[model samples]
Target: MMTMHPQTPDILPRVAFVATGGTIAGTMTEDSKTSWAYSSAQRSGESLVMGIPGLLRRAQWHFEQPYSIGSQNLELGHMLQLRAVLLRLLESPEIDSIIVTHGTDTMEDMLYFLHLTVPSHALGKPVLFTGSMLPSDHEQADGPGNISGAFEFLIQCLSTNADVSGHSAMPFGLCMQGLFTPAHRVEKQSTAGLDAFDGPYSVLANTQWLLSRNALEMSEDSGVQGQFASLFDPTATRHPLFEAMEVPVVFCTPGNGPLRQLTDLLNRKPASVVVAAPGHGNIPEACVPVLRRLLLNGVSVVRASRVIAGGVEQGGEFDALDAFRQAPVQGGNAVFSEAGGLNLSKCVMYERLRVLAHSLSV
Candidate 1:
């Protein structure tokens, strides 16, 4: 049997806390309005440890970046920078774990991105992502508790070398909401509840590593890693010289003018368009003509719902099939192009286009 070494001074785990401003570092005013307002009076990431005395006493702490921003402001570039930083830290022989203090609003999206970007071989150290729904300045803030929990979790993860293989096998990506995987699979159980991430799968019991090294090795050998990397590198400049493909996203609102404006935008940019239907991917009949014009101009129009819970249904009440056929008929396009479902889909499509472009160039 392999003997596990006890954590002591000789084997003390070093932890890096990367704080990229979120509610975790946000300030609340005396009026009780939660805001992303930063105050010089507020404690910094380094001060967080002092704020919660005795927390993380055994571990060495390092803060990557201080000053919090709302998660809504997080972008792809930020994700890239964070990944590069994490990779750099992972290369360090002393660092044993990493904790990211993020805002809960878009934490899952960021976590999934990190999940895809961080290499498994370089991921031996524990990487715990945590945040609180309440601001740190709130009188009844959960930030302190959550941060404490995250630190404890990281220590435990490093001590045990928990198995993360399951995470690696996920076909889509991991979405951690209050400690639940595929966070979309779980719904927020309570409005201000501590166990907001409660799901049917009993997530609290399954603290094992989401993905294993062996699985990553197999996937890497199969070239999946390379393919995924190529798909995600949006800065790739090479492209095939072919008929332009434009995708348009039309946001349907109470007024018909928004759709018309979108159509006008689509006309200006000669590419396929994906209409972000207001409800169940439904567009107003008044806006149908705008879509029709784009189709007439050879632009492919796809339907995507703005609703976050459910996806766009095919051959549904919206006459989606006919509309698609009337258009140039490219596949579905995402309404938003950020690091969510839409971005993930776009990444896959872009990868295919890149491969085709490379083939054509050859």
Candidate 2:
């Protein structure tokens, strides 16, 4: 091994590697590789980040954990705190880049939320998020490799976009198993695969790449989430909804079964409701009347499909009794996905931002 040349300390990128625990910080109670059998949030951020010096040899990693908890228990309050920490770190003169180890389950949600809320001033530095399918100590652990690859990704961004400027938002990507996907597109696909996330490298992704060399170069195409990138512009105003608003999800099931929940939700009268519709976001004929009543009662409704692939398209015709596709209601705040690209979780965040924007304008 040619381990001759030593790395210059000053040349290394200063990375604030924030660990908000997930399987990467997890440890199995018994001697097992089973992902579900493990306890998450067991390790500290320093313990998780310090091991990277041997693999990457590039960045000087600093450890910071906003808090330790599984993604399932992730709440809006935690994310507001995280947004605060990330904005502080990115704006800091000490740090040159950032790599966050977050739970894969709600990682995309946080990314999408941050994509909307993070100020443009903080977008200059490289921000990359990553986590693992297996625990840190597992024999076939992928956290080390994922972390190494993620660090390399930031280096590539710093190298490429050092002089690039004037864009409203800089590149932020999710790295898993060698695939680097943009914030707007990344989604968790598998529960058990070593490489558990996919976007540009997904099997169903439009373009194909070998994942062997150069994923960061492909990231330029994945940069800045077009129209969905900004809402509630931090520079313009500080609307309280950014941190406090809540959008509840309602799933449309077969027949009259969902009526009870819909009735309860109607009584709750939330700001917005994101419905997981059957087929292409189709509201069942039976529930149409109640949905109308909800809409008339000033509860906004946004439709998303339960199906994995194709999203709900607007202006699509529907037969009698069934509510139309992902279109805004006649006189309410139903937010439509400009394109048929939003999934259920995305629709939730999108609706939140839409409500925030609507509130800011008023």
Candidate 3:
């Protein structure tokens, strides 16, 4: 644990700032000044902090880069590597919290993955995520301000011991320009706007200006269940990705066709097939027979929605197919488990399906 100086009691927490390469770490040509025209993953996390004056003196923080790639190109291997780093950090008694500086493109997906896989005991301290719409060196770049917001939020949480229910309820947070959002509820609504995040949920903190002086405030608990809680075997010591890496999977959006393509995908003997459909997880009626054939063949089938929020409803098309049952893989029963909560985002549903495919048969 980092010691606190009596003269500066404020500098009491120890933090780990993990970087996974994003627009927040981007840079441009010496003459270029606009955020739109720049190369990404050019700057290290250390360099990003240095760009923000007085950041180094804020806390006893350390930096580590697992990999540097654009979020658009992020793969399963990269996510697993990041999960490994987070596990190591969260287990450290010396670290009070973590702040991930990433690109905004896949931040929600990344957060959802972490939320599902990371154990509750390991996530005792807050693990927050932040990024910039603009590059690090843009004249009006948003990286520094976002980082500052995260740092300040951590300071407040550590100083006050932010546990409302006598337990650490919110182990992860997403801090943007001036708003601190809950990870599962965060969404990137715009491509280039400074205020690009929106949540149908409540804001955790709204620290507008007064970066150095304002106190952090808490909002009502969103009551988000660890809905995908059964997806992982809690007793397992190794990260879930170890098995997930071996699974060959397919993610597709429903369309007009004879479903020959779906048959081709199943021929590979994949662990599961994820259908990203429209309007509460409904797919074309033509695709149903093929899907039913695949489901009957012991292949796992998952229904996920493309909508930002509100999961799928149970009795609609799913009832007609009689697709109710636990996922064949170890952890979850998949769509058969429940309705309403199953309507997951396309990316999140794909990840859950991956976990299910890799899961050991019970």
Candidate 4:
């Protein structure tokens, strides 16, 4: 007879893996080295999760595959679908946390869309998103490591009591960039870095978990579903209300054309115009006239800073205060301006104008 060793206790928290296919699920065919293909060989999300070295053994795991499409092929409708699924999960009490395996290509856009649509409170839970730069089938692929890192991050968040419960009034917390971050501030910093995302504000504290509070409160009475249905109609009209809507985007340089170029773009009768101005959303004295002209022409003119890492602060020389105090209010809506700087501002304006057009139609 032999003495038996004592069993070690399990300490990992239960995790739910939501696999939205990307390069992580892609494989390379031996014959065609030039082509990348997806294989059903490792099709199931659960099987993929179990294939990871220690994830399944460490935690009680669950899996759901909403779709197996590549990330590059993702569309706005797909994002809405993903949001619907996530909303359902957030409403459920059985799941402890969520991990979304996604492609890196459009991850930033997806993150921003989620941040804007989901309420701060629903964000209180530990929802981690991770993906690999390399395909899973490659010998030196980063997929396994990234997945392992995500699982480890979830374990750390739960074990440290950082994923707090019942804190439903605050924004949901997200762990990305091989660390934790808020969805709004999550952005990609490098094309091929393992730790690609950067959250400058440090919105996520290791001890804090996001609480889902004040989500856009879905209702049967609301016509949002009907509106969404209309979007799918092949005959639905898609048009921007203000024609030739264009924004002049320029980075900070000593002598980049301040306002002349912006005013010129506005002269084309763009419904709205955005200026990727210098630091703190400031424009040179020369550019103010261009802004004024656009406003006079009933063209919406917005100012966003050139800074990539921080928000444009108010109370600067080129701030909207002066425009607000002036009569006729030619300046456009500053609300359309975004903190992520020019590119994001463009996207925000595009979406805003799209909404405005829709409202006009109905």
- What is the TM-score of candidate 1? 0.66
lDDT of 1 by residue, 1-362 (tens): 12223357786667788787776777776555564434322446766666776765767778877335677776555666666677777667666667777766666566545544455555555566666666676677777777776666565554665543433322222224335343223233344555565544324312453443233232111123223343333332222322133334556679866666765765484444556667667767777776665555544455666675445545456772364452124433312211123322333333233333443545
User: Each model's C-alpha lDDT?
Assistant: 0.53, 0.66, 0.63, 0.55
The ten-residue window of minimal lDDT in model 1 covers: 218-227
Task: List model 3 lDDT by residue over 91-210, tens digit each.
Answer: 777777899988888887777666556655566676789999988877888999999888877766666555523224434758887677665556677776888885444354533212
Point out where model 2 deviates above 4 Å.
Answer: 1-10, 31-36, 53-57, 159-162, 166-170, 201-244, 319-339
* The 10-residue segment with the lowest total lDDT in model 3: 213-222
Candidate rank order under TM-score = 2, 3, 1, 4
Per-structure clash totals for the candidates: 19, 0, 4, 12
lDDT of 2 by residue, 252-274 (tens): 77666677777887778777777
Better of 1 and 3 by lDDT: 3
TM-score of 2: 0.80
Candidate 4 per-residue C-alpha lDDT over 22-54 given as tens digits, one digit per residue, 9 for 90 to 100: 766666667536664444223456766777876
What TM-score does each of the candidates earn? 0.66, 0.80, 0.77, 0.63
Model 1: how far residue 189 lies from native, Å: 8.5
Candidates 2 and 3: which is better by TM-score?
A: 2
How much is the lDDT of residue 74 in candidate 1? 64
Candidate ranking under lDDT, highest first, comes to: 2, 3, 4, 1
